[model samples]
Target: MSEEANQIVQINSSEFSWNKKDGVFHFDGAPALLFWDNAFKIFLSTIMEISGPDASNAVFETTGFRMGLLVNDYYQNRFTIEEVIKKYSEIYSSAGWGNVTITSLYKY
Candidate 1:
């Protein structure tokens, strides 16, 4: 397999720790994996400010699986594994303003 063959990858996540402010979901664990979109990024930031340093994230696995489902469910749809990977890579890269990272993509 060549690198060019696979296009799309998967959403990447960083380590996030669970935090607790007087016993709350303040991401105080240890920064296991954090993923955020527009809404999520805001949420993460807010939480961080409110609580403390508990969680860290880069991106999500699937911003939304609806599209992927559609393609997969389509009877006529037939994408090679590599093709699907490519598609993910394109989206991940395209999501610049979104500011997302590339994670492991599914082989199938």
Candidate 2:
């Protein structure tokens, strides 16, 4: 990543808070959880095994779309459109979703 991209994706540790007693984590005061990718893959594969690929795809797509809308609403309140565009990768990366590179952006 370029230096600028690195800066853009930098996350501050202070944004995350842990509540040991409650067994919960929060990022920017919003509840969050961290899980290994392998574990998630196993869970997904199990779903596929039970439901089949077609059903699992529909299930995943519906869940993802709803979750994405919620995420967009959350960020929309906290950031301007431009800020959201620039910080999209940073938000996901900080949430442990993996690095995202916006190689190209287009506006309609």
Q: What lDDT does the true structure give each of the candidates? A: 0.43, 0.73
Q: Could you tell me which 10 consecutive residues in candidate 1 have the lowest summed lDDT?
A: 23-32
Question: Residue 106 in model 1: shift from native, Å?
Answer: 8.1
> Which regions of candidate 2 are displaced past 4 Å?
1-10, 103-108
Q: In model 1, what lDDT does residue 69 have?
A: 65
lDDT of 2 by residue, 68-103 (tens): 898778777888867776776776678887778776
Steric clash pairs (candidate 2) = none
Q: Per the 3 Å backbone cut-off, how many clashing residue pairs does candidate 2 have?
A: 0
Residue 31 of model 2 has an lDDT of 77
